[model samples]
Target: MKKIILSLLVLVLAASCQEQQKIAFVDNGQVIEDYQMKIDMEAKFKKQDEAYKRKTDSIGQAYQLDAQQTQLKLSSLSQKKQQEGSQQFSQKWQLIQQQLQYEQQQMEQAFSKEMDSVIKSVNKFVEGYGEKNGYTFILGKNAAGSVMFGKEEKDISEAVTKAINDDYNGKDSKEDATETTEKEEDK
Candidate 1:
């Protein structure tokens, strides 16, 4: 009876000592905002947006100049010529407006798609991170509150962000090295 009770106690203790499933939560917004890749991508997009704006402004200014010139000459022309010129100007202006609208829409769609891809990439990285780290579950807490109340100790946003940035920096360094090697070879 003593031996059986001792053995049972040991078994219970061993079972109690078994590792529990690890769980963590990441603040998705915090992680993405601190991510270096996202910052760089946003800067690139901003530059592109500025360039597009400049191009559109140039086109708009040229159209405006042409329209103003047409308006100035309208009063001096015969009524028929004035009517024809006005009609031509209106058609050209409409065409330019439509083109600008289409270009703006395309630019917006492209930016939206790129942003979506970046977000997806971030989410994928987090998923892989959880898998590699042996986390049984990694919940995301965003504005929508997928994770309502995770303990502060279990929030891995900073660690995950650092890991992601380090990974990004490593890839950038590798790319830079490759580019340098190619240039040296060309020389």
Candidate 2:
């Protein structure tokens, strides 16, 4: 009877000793805001987007000018020449439209590729951080949506964001206080 009791006790203690790992989920949307590399990537993307927009707008304006010139040339042509010119202009316009579409698709793919790279970097960083910090799991949330059903304790969004920002900013509490003092003196 004592042997059986000891066996049971040992089993219970062993089972209890196997710690259940803690898992946490962070709203990666917020984390991205504090992630410096992600911020730099976004800034680069914005500049590329603006440049693409300007190029597309220039192409559109060129197309409009060509159309206006075609209209004028058509009026000055003989009826037969007008028909031929119009047909040629229509074919050229169609080709230009196709080219524009291809360019837009290329731009979109490039942007998507850049965004994917940024996301992958962020994911790798988060995974390494979680492992180092003893988090069994870390889940990313959609930036466009809200977390409707996570347990409050498991939602480490704020902690993750704060930690990331604090690390990224590189200004510890003491540095921040000193900076504040300097600013006050300057004022």
Candidate 3:
């Protein structure tokens, strides 16, 4: 009886001493905001957006100028000629409007697709970081509250951000090195 009690106590103690599963939470919003890749991507998109706006505005101005010229000419023309000029201007205006709308829709769809790809890349990087760091679970704490309240120590957003930034920097360095090599070869 004594020996059996000692054996059970030893088994219980051994089981209790086993390591606990590692879990951490990341502030998704903070990670996204501070991520270097995201920052660069957003800047690129902003520039592209400005260029698109300029192009659209230029096209609109051209249409406006054309309409104004047509109006001015119509006032001095005979009735039959005025009617013919009005119909031609109306058709041209409608076609321009349709083309502008189509271009806007296409730009929106392309932008949306590119943004989605960037978001997915970020998520994949986070997942890979968690796995490589031996985290059993890495919960994302966003505004939606997927993780309600994690202890400060268990929040790994900074570490994850650093890891991602380092990875991005490494890639950039490699590209720079490759470009330098190509230039040297050209020389």
Candidate 4:
């Protein structure tokens, strides 16, 4: 029984000595914010929003003009006729409002879907980065607080952000090639 216990202890010691787990965590919010794709997408969405506003404003101005002209025409009519005309204009305005609302909703949905895709791509990139670097684990720290506390040295958010931005800008492969060239020159 003693010998068996010694053997178990030896096995545990050997396993412990084999390798240390390499863990790191990234501030997901910072990484996403620095990602070039996200920045570009945000700019694109902003422009789209502005364009929508301009178009709507133009439509609104046209509607206002029509309403003014309509009121002028109705002023010459009888009271009953004026009431019916007012109702018709009100219905037309309601339709315009609904149309504007629907367009805005559609724009919002498209922006949301695009952003979700961006997030998925970023996740995939991080997974690949971890695997390529032989990391045992790469955790994320986000608004939800997946990681409550980690050593500052273990916080690799900056590195991850740089790597991701490099990848986004298509510089990762180029940098890898440059490193290989430098290695050959050293040899």
Candidate 5:
């Protein structure tokens, strides 16, 4: 009917005239870089890497000592026996080298896996933050240019970074909200 069509048009117009969505953006790189968890993880991995280096160095020293003794024994060996001893020593060295390479790769893989977890946590936190704060849309601006341009005022990257760090430090979001409200009231 004409009346039904008119009513639908009126409703649509009213909805369209309502306030726009609450949208904002964050710098993806900055948020991840400034996150305390990532920093802590990096430090942890660095310490582990240094310890690994020390351990490998010790293993090499021990191997060199043993190799020297083997060399001395080989020197007193018959020519044919010396050649066999050298071949066996060479094969052992190759095995050691392979083991070291494999261990190094494993450590690298572990590091990568941990970093991936950190990144996922950050993204999940950001999603929860946007939902809890009544955001209609929250864009992430990364190097790939997902967001071409955004107003500086709408860039909530710093607040988000601080919030995430506070969360990492075991500080609640409610406390942060209360503090922000109090600051605004004082102002």
Candidate 6:
């Protein structure tokens, strides 16, 4: 009975050691920002942003010119007519400003929504990669503030960036293999 109990204790101790996990840390922010796909997205956004700004500026300049013309015409009117024209001009100006503000807000919201979708897709790819590679825990840079201590080897930033870019580029492992097999079969 003592021998049997000793054997069971040894087995439990061995199992406990075997269950120890390997952990890796990554700077997820750096990975995302430095990713090739993310850079392209940023460039696209900047291009669209410049175009939007140009359009907004043109509208603003036209509005200002129209308002100036209305003001110029105000001096030629009777007092009662002048008051009514001034009030109408105020209302129109307010409405135009409000509309511009709302349009800018809508553009920002739309950009945010699209960025959220892209980030979610990147996260899903990371999760799938971790699972396939048997990683017990893949910690983000913010996980424990351990990534900012200047340990270059501990940083998996490049790997995460490459993985994300590769995923975004649709270089799927199985798809590539299947395509190769099909080509060979065709030949």
- Candidate with best lDDT: 5
Full ranking by TM-score: 4, 5, 1, 6, 3, 2
Alpha-carbon deviation at 36 in model 4, angstroms: 0.4
| Model 2 alpha-carbon drift over 4 Å, by segment | 1-10, 141-148, 162-187
- Residue-wise lDDT of candidate 5 within 39-118, one digit each (tens)? 99999989989998998899899889989998999999899999999999989888988998998899899989998998
> CA lDDT of each candidate?
0.80, 0.71, 0.78, 0.84, 0.86, 0.71
Task: Supply the global lDDT for candidate 3.
Answer: 0.78
lDDT (Cα, tens digit) per residue for candidate 1, span 98-150: 98789788878887887787789889987877776667888999999799998
Tens-place lDDT digits, model 2, residues 78-143: 999999998998899799779878977887888778778767766776676576566677777775
Model 6 stretches astray by more than 4 angstroms: 1-12, 143-152, 172-187
Tell me the tens digit of each residue's lDDT in model 3 across 79-107.
99999999999898789778878977887
Report per-prediction Cα RMSD to one decimal: 9.9, 7.8, 9.7, 4.6, 4.0, 7.3
Deviation from native of the Cα of residue 75 in model 1, angstroms? 1.1
* TM-score leader: 4
Q: Over the stretch 85-173, how does candidate 6's per-residue lDDT look in tens digits? A: 99998898789788878978887887788778767766776677566545576677755575556455545556656666766777665
For residues 1-187, could you state the per-residue lDDT of candidate 4 as single tens digits? 9999999999999998997776778898988898889999999999999999999999989999999999999999999999999999999989989999999999999999999988998899889877776678889998898999988777767767777778888885446534533442343
Worst 10 residues of 5 by lDDT: 178-187
- Considering summed lDDT, which 10 consecutive residues are worst modelled in model 1? 176-185
> Which of the two candidates, 5 or 6, achieves a greater TM-score against the reference?
5
How much does candidate 3 score in TM-score?
0.75
